[model samples]
Target: MMIPIRKEQRQENMHLKKTPMTKDMKKGMIEDMKKLKRYSTVIKSYSYMKAFRLLATSLLVALSMGFTSCGEDELDRMPSTSLDEGTLFDKTDKLFSEYIKDYSNIKCRYGLQGESSVLLSGLKDNHLWFSEYDAVSKQLKSEWIDIEKTDTIQQLYKGYGEYETLYVKYVAPLYYKEISTGNIVTFNIGGRFQTIFTSNHKAKRTQLQYDNSKNGIAHNWYKESVFIADCCYSHEGDTIYIAKSRPSFDENGNLAGVTLVSYEEGIELSGRYINRRSFKEGKSVWSTYIAPPFDVPSDAKRNYTLLGNTTNIWEYKCEVTFYDGTKRDFTFKINIDNGKIVTDEIKVTGISINENTVNLKQGETFQLTATVQPDNATNNKVIWSSSNETVASISQEGLVTANSAGETNITVTTEDGNFSTTAIVTVTSNEDEDKATLARLEGTWDMLKCYGWEYNDQNIKENWEENVVGEYIFFEDEDGNGGYNDGYKTYYFASSVEGNKLILRNSEWLDGKTSIIITKLTETELHLKAIDSVSEENYEMKRR
Candidate 1:
């Protein structure tokens, strides 16, 4: 049923003149055709009613042309020729058959013949058109071609006719229904408004699909496909089309050409952000910016036209009339200022840090994270800094280290707008002194000098320079529970401390207990004298 019409062949055939018939000859044509004996009876008698109607209309048109030619000069008239009745009827039948054949070729392109229905016919069923107007003068500026029409109800499920068989095998799955009653066509278009352009417009375009369940927003744009010329793009890092220059229209009602638009280099449409109340735990909870509507009349009858300019900001107000004769007005602004095409409002509420206040001991570290909101913010770059570096220092990657025991503020600022939020950092000196003292005593020590005093001897302990000299000692803790390790023997004892004194309980020997008086304890030297009921031992040790 899809008949392809060759334009060149059609033009050539239009110039071929048809043979003329006089008014007197047309009156007896049916009877004369019936008298032909060589042809079938059906063709001779005009058995088909549809075919008969076609023959009658064609004969009447030929007779009318013949009468009009009679008024011309006699010298311009061509001599008439006689034709057989059978041949004349055959030629007329063939012409009527071709006319019926051409009528059977058109079909709906988007659906199956027996099961599908048409939502909006791409060919000429338009009731509303997109129009642009001047903001200052309020006059019609440019007009585009009639794009599409809205429907009042769902289409009936009638199958395609024999002439519409071209749609039988091509069934489209997209379900879109329109209900329009003179105005206000309400249909779900994924939060996107439909705009049609001429074939040769050459402007870059984005087609967005809206679905609430898929996108989590009231009117979410789920998918976007950008197009330039005949090719389409959807990959990341592609050049984004922003605004467009006005189009030029030809006298023949066609789009002459178009110019694409690019955004500014450094200027930005500043976004407002806020902190989110509900978010995942342990994650930064920043809010995102929300964009306002474009604010053009959604359902209007005016056709689309070119804009006057693309650089300055333009304020537009649109009025929509519903089917019941009720009206509503919407106003929004759009402009290309400083080489940037921007909408009116931005919707970033605030930013939030994962931890508002963090407590750490000196010389400890913790990581901090910050989030930016509205999900689609143009600039999410954040700057991380600390108020006092002596108290705490933060890395560019948001790792905060406590230097000394003090407090500071960890601030995260947005690079584009300078919006900032802070986290309080508190570092305390809790057990750092005890830990440092324990660290200093945890190494090997060598006994440099030793002395012993017998019970029978005099008042002071005398030096026994040859005893326990050059012996290696190790202190596992500040309690000092280690002894000399003479190559073949490993001396062991339970060591602990009471204030500054070191106590060693030697379980290897019965009643062997030593309490050493600490005279000097430095990084290089340690001097101690242990006295018990048996004997007094004085030892001087040096770190190995």
Candidate 2:
């Protein structure tokens, strides 16, 4: 038969009722109460056994006295005063119930339950001790759990026992999750990890950020709230973390605080950052240098710390990763030995231009260029590229040339591999084809050799120098030679009385004192001499 419940409390049990002590029931009844005494918080009088038996028999007889509504769940129970805060803890082997009290009294907001929940009976830094009764065990269990484990595989939908709920949300677009806003971050936080300063709001405000850095390559800072996912930045402009990534908006609502992240730089163990905090004003830099990891032992990078209310000197510490995964350290330490961060945090900001969309005309060439500079950064390196090789191609140093009639785009990517963009290129045909003049200059000619020199007074025959390529000038028997470039001296062919005659006239710059000569026009042989005034020089043309 099912065990009956207490009046007005409806608690269910698995006990077998003994028939009131007839001669046979007395001995068994004594043993049962003794066993009950071993587990019960309240001890009943040994002498009252007979009276209890009578009372129990009377209760069974009055079946009309219906059972009360007691439930077996520990959460539904009234405060158990019979519980010896000391012995109750010794049997359960943990302090889950006590954890609720200390945890709630500390008023930490991050999911530690209130007084109505499990009480924190004990604590060690990062390890917690609390107590709660398990229904199946029918006895309160004092629980001591490791308090600092925070990495995740899947997710815990809710908390243990009747404690506050906990969950996780992966915010990144890739299968790899990103640190997102509104994600509930829970830690094994031991009982001792609790403090008077403990507050759930303070702990969960730790936000995770997607940083372009080396040391902490796979991790993010869980140090702030994430109200928005994407942000816009200017070329070398300051990215003010306004309510959402903008700066200074006392009008659109003022800044609660700032988020400054950098490459491998993590939160320094000294100063205000050593102690964690929620988002607050002047707590960060306007610029963040996210490239390396801090002094911590993990690959995840974004480390954060708090700053004092009006200080401008934000110091930071960072680690440089060697090519083979080893790390070196750097520091921007703003000493807060006075127990507060007496400096302002700065954020390093930048933007990348899209470069994959370029167009051009046939036979034209261009140089591709990439520029990466921070609003406060110096000596930043950048890379450039193109979209199509068939239509247009770009050089390693950013030179581009259009090879075909089609269109293509050019792309420019950042060195950090954080961003990329493209530009358009359109090509048209060249329209100046008529101005070329080298189509008719193909021919062969040669000079001739002669043995006899018949020049009187060393005068050259003028007709011999006509239709030539070399520079020449016409001169008298005593003057210099004829001119060419500015104006070529003329070799005039005259037919006086039907006989061919030649005259070398120094025209343009040369005066009337010039030579006259005559020779039959031939493709390969010519004999000539200069005037006596210039020189007694004979000229011969020969062809091979």
Candidate 3:
């Protein structure tokens, strides 16, 4: 810390006194040494702190040397070496991904990509793809195989028509045909396995390749070859088949499925390891959303992103599944200068609503939402829907609405690799006023007591009246009374003054009649209770 604290050396040099001329020379030399430190380059040999101490010491020495004939500019004691540590190796895709994640200094986005695939005549279109390794150096100019000279996947793209490397690399999808039927078509033309039906043409817009040129790699389209095998579409897209591309073309032209091929967007060439804010970019995983792929809403658009330099570095795109069960990709990157999504590689799996049963009345609407999580979801694109297409269907936003009166389950799907959740939505046209009413008072009801006490008692014999006078308790509206109690076969009457009270007349009095009071009413349920009755009872009912 303090120059190793050389106490013995300092003590030994302290006892030596210099002559008057020597002292003056040492002082002059120390003064001269202070002038050389003005240049920052001269401190190359010293650590940041050491440099300061050396400058101070040299200044003291220069002051002494100025008075003497000793060489005042003797800086030979300082070591000589190049100051450059050389640009960082870009070692690993770590820094590059971090730099690009927030790559604000560059004129263009670090690794922006092309829109979805377009119609490629196998002659008039250019290709989009990428290859990368964990380690690479920029020094290799004409070649791209790295220092080992070993052939990497980047070699396949070496002459994909003079496409030069860019500051940003991305893995863009290659689409063709008028529409993407989710059916990857492979045919033999010119003796090579060529893919023909994997279309991504939207609005007949005549798509342009990343290089803005024609593609010439049909030499090895989908054909039978030693380089490919074991091809099958995802369970989501059964008819579609894709294969690993190679620099060489297959001799036999056969569409039969495909061999599992590895594809990386140009933006991920630095490494699969992404920044913390975005996807980790290791292995890719995929899943499906609610309903089968075709059953989703026709207007339902798919949204996702690929983890790039930064979390903000994304490729924002919309996808729509057709009635015929085809998926198409689109991007607004053309309209917005810097769109939000760098990559659109999200895979949805299982999704489910929190509610298992939701009840609604006629003309009344309710919302059902679900959460979707993907296993390897670089993109959070999810699909939600219902099993019975006719009864109820779900929206892309995971909201379910009541279409008709019936029982239906809302299912949600993230992707093949995600979790799915479902809820049973039951819609009925019943009003709430009845549910609350009948719930508290269930079972057949009958009159229990009559109004205006007509009991025969010793204390008040005059109160007894049967043949001449009668008292009745009954349920009634503002008009009058209710019908006969089928259980008791008794007639009832409501007092014109207060007949609206729901009550029952009891046989002990004159006739069995009950008074009822409605306290609450709503769309689904109604609550009612008998007041001052044989037994305090409440009734709640739901619509049938």
Best by lDDT: 1
List the candidate 1 regions with Cα displacement exceeding 4 Å.
Answer: 1-345, 359-366, 395-397, 415-420, 426-544
Judging by TM-score against the true structure, name the best candidate.
3
Off by over 4 Å in 2: 1-11, 14-369, 372-422, 425-544
Report the C-alpha lDDT of model 3 over 1-544, residue by residue, as the tens digit.
0111124334534434332324453343233333221221121111221211112222322221111010001111111122132111111122234322421111100111112111111110112211111123312111010111111112122244644322111111121111112222222111112233222231111112232122222222222211122232221222223333222222222222222222211122112121111112333233112222234464555543432222322433345556666787544221111222323455555555668787754345556666555444454445677776455667777556666667787776653455666778776534333343333333323233222332244544222112312222233443333433334455654322222243433333323435556555455444555444333444444422
Error of 3 at 199 (Å): 30
lDDT of 2: 0.31
Q: Per-prediction TM-score, please?
A: 0.21, 0.20, 0.24
Candidate 1: tens digits of C-alpha lDDT, residues 1-544: 1111235334534444445656554444333222221111111112111221112222212221111011011222222344433223223223223322331121111110111111111111222222222333433333222334332221222234212111110111111111111111111221222222222222221222232122111110113322222222222213333223212223321223322232211111122211222111322123333223433243532221233333233333444455556655544344333222245345355677899999998888999998877555544567899999999999988999999888999999875467789999999864555445445666887877777665545555444444555576677766555655754576876655544566567734223545667677799888777777767777788988
- TM-score rank order: 3, 1, 2
Task: Count steric clashes of candidate 1.
Answer: 23
For 1-544, candidate 2 gives per-residue lDDT tens digits of 1222233323232332323224333343233323222212111111111221111222222322211111232221112212222222122222322333223221111111222222222223322222333333424343323233232122222223332322211100000111221112112211101111112222211122222110011111223222222221111111224222223212212223333332211222421234222223324332232333234444434333443312323455554454566656654534222223323333324445535455555678876556554543321335556567777777767778887666677776554434555667666543211111101111221333323223445465333223334533222222222222323344422111111222333344223424434343344444444443533334454423
Alpha carbon deviation, residue 481, candidate 3 (Å)? 11
Error (Å) of candidate 3 at residue 330 is 19
The 10-residue segment with the lowest total lDDT in model 3: 68-77
Q: List per-prediction Cα lDDT, in the order shown.
A: 0.40, 0.31, 0.31
Give the lDDT of residue 81 in candidate 3. 23
Clashes per candidate, residues 3 or more apart or on different chains: 23, 124, 121
Poorest stretch of ten by lDDT in candidate 1 = 109-118
